[model samples]
Target chain A: MFLGVLFSGGKDSVFACRRAMETDSVVCLITVISENPDSYMFHTPNVRWAHLIAEAIGVPQLLWSTRGEEEAELSDLRDAVAAAKKSYGIEGVVTGAIESVYQAARVQRICRELDLWCYNPLWQIDQVEYLRLLVEEGFEVIVTGVFAYPLDESWVGAKIDDRLIRELESLQKRYGINPSGEGGELETFVLDGPILKKRIEILRASKTYENYRGRLTIEEARLVDK
Target chain B: MILIVDLCHKAESLSKYEFVDPIASIVRRTGSEFKVRHFSELTAKEIERSDGIVLCGTPLKDDLRARRIELFIWIRDFDRPLLAICAGMQVVAAVFGGEIVPQPKIGLERIEILKETDLLGPPGEIEGYHLHNFGVTLPSGFDLVAGRAGQIEAFKHSGRPIYGIIFHPEVRNKWIVERFLDLG
Candidate 1:
């Protein structure tokens, strides 16, 4: 079956796209860019650069914009998905939702309305184990945002590796933070992965941190050879 | 050993990770051994060797109508504790002479447990994750365990330990799955 993934250029969505590719053809990558940085429905950090990730992965991308109002953005999502169905003839939609019922349920409702099958490959997954899987599976993911305490400026631009995974595991036990950032404690962006045809090279980026909230804005990036 | 039967559209389909693996993970976390097999690939020998059976859900778009519902004829005679979820519930109900009605639901909703069983303890209201295009009617010879008669949220066989629930227990109600394992 041909499917379209709700891509955020994040580790979860990237990994989900790869998993979807294993069983079926991922015909397109659908990215919903929200103006609200704290949008509950979609990931926000450096999502506009999703086209680059799409180009790197060699999948056609469908970009949609939303004003990011809480309930109103869902209609924008519906429009985007409807457009994907019309353009790509996608039979279903794939999501990276792991534990957020709020996000997963809304997407499920939209898919049902659109008569498209929805798949959340990372639903109810073990967070720490999944972070480990991301590194072990050759996914070069970096933290792009941090929202919770005890995670300071250092995490904003760090690559996810064994050392970071160990630290996240310890933080999970000590501070009750979700290692995979399912709880909105952190956000990630995938630069390279097993499924990507090319890797992302960050040319220049700026980091901003204050009082346990931080974001790494990728000002410039280009696709490079893996 | 618990047998987790995958009811997705096909064996090893993309839906397996969403529907099957989570339940398998929950069962594994209980320290009980489990084996996962698609409904079409399940053998009588596999069923006979299992202590309990958990028929997992599927993507809402991949209901049992696309597959051979007759393959589930084994459910009628199997006396072990069997818990069917979502599409699996539709199969269990269809096998037992029940109607599969169009009751499309998605997202987290309130579930009222009308009849308490070993699987779901006591009658109360609890929120459960529901993602299905259809729901099963109360199959004959099955007691209404939850929800109203027509819109059965949960049901159990009158004489056996067989059960069917529309909600995906692997979501917020994983205790139900762990409790089903305990029923083994």
Candidate 2:
């Protein structure tokens, strides 16, 4: 069956897409750009890079702009999925849902309305195993945003690898933080993966922190030949 | 030692698989050492070297399905403790005189074990994450041990160390893998 992935330019979404690709052909990547940075239902940060990463994966990207109003954004998601269905013949929509009952239920509702299968390959699986596979599979991931204690400014622009996974595991022992950043403790961006044709290079970036929250603004980036 | 026969080969063409990796983790969780080999590379000598076997599933692509059918027939006479998952189970059913038709209501369903067995260990409810478009019929001389809404979920040979399950034990039931390994 053909699939359309709701890509958020994050490790979870990109990795979900990879998992979907394992079983079925992913014909399109759906990216929603939320106007609200504090959106609860959708990711807003590093969204501008969704297309570039989609390009890197060599898949057709379907885009949508949402006003970020609470439940209204879900309608925009339906519209994006409709467009993908009409254009790509997608039989299902792939999501990066981990342990969020709220998000999974909403996406499942929308998929039910659209008569399309909602596939959450990462749902309820062990996060430690998920992070380890990301490293082993050569997924180039970076932290773009952090918004919790114990994870400070130093984490803002760090590449996630085996070493980082260990650090996160230790932090989990103390703070009970999610190793995959599912707790909104941090946000990530994927620069490359096994499926990507090119790798992204952040030539310039600036990190800022305030009151335990931090962000690395990617001022410039370019795709380099792998 | 157990052998994970990863039939999701022809990786140069087919997509990378995530189906059986969790099984690998399950093996490690049981403190078991296992080796993975592509189905094309599997041999009788290899089967003789292992304690048990787990045959993994893949999409039923025509060429790959042909290769799989050949392999199932090739290994039909295997007497070792063997467990197959999803597509692998479908392969077992097709090879052992059973039916495989397109699945009608394909979604998440709770499977209840209808019969008792050491491999299931007092089975009551097992959560099955269903995705395949096909369903398998009980093969000849096999017990219909599990089902959901009358659809078959598991079956075992009448008198052999072989079993086939429709759901992914790696996803929801680590105990099932442990039980299968224990049969070795």
User: Of the candidates shown, which would achieve the greatest lDDT relative to the real structure?
Assistant: 1
Give Cα-based local distance difference scores for all models.
Answer: 0.91, 0.79
Among all windows of 10 consecutive residues in model 2 chain A, the one with the lowest summed lDDT is: A99-108
lDDT of 1 by residue, B14-115 (tens): 889989999999999999999999988999999999999998898888865435878989998999999999988999999999989998888888999988
- Model 2 gets an lDDT of 0.79
The TM-score of candidate 1 is 0.98
Supply DockQ values for each candidate. 0.86, 0.07
Clashing pairs in 2: B103-B133
Docking class of 2: incorrect
Worst 10 residues of 2 chain B by lDDT: B9-18
> On residues A56-120, what C-alpha lDDT tens digit does candidate 2 reach at each position?
99999998999998888889888989999999999888888776656766776677667886777
What TM-score does candidate 2 reach?
0.72
Candidate 1 chain A weakest ten by summed lDDT? A37-46
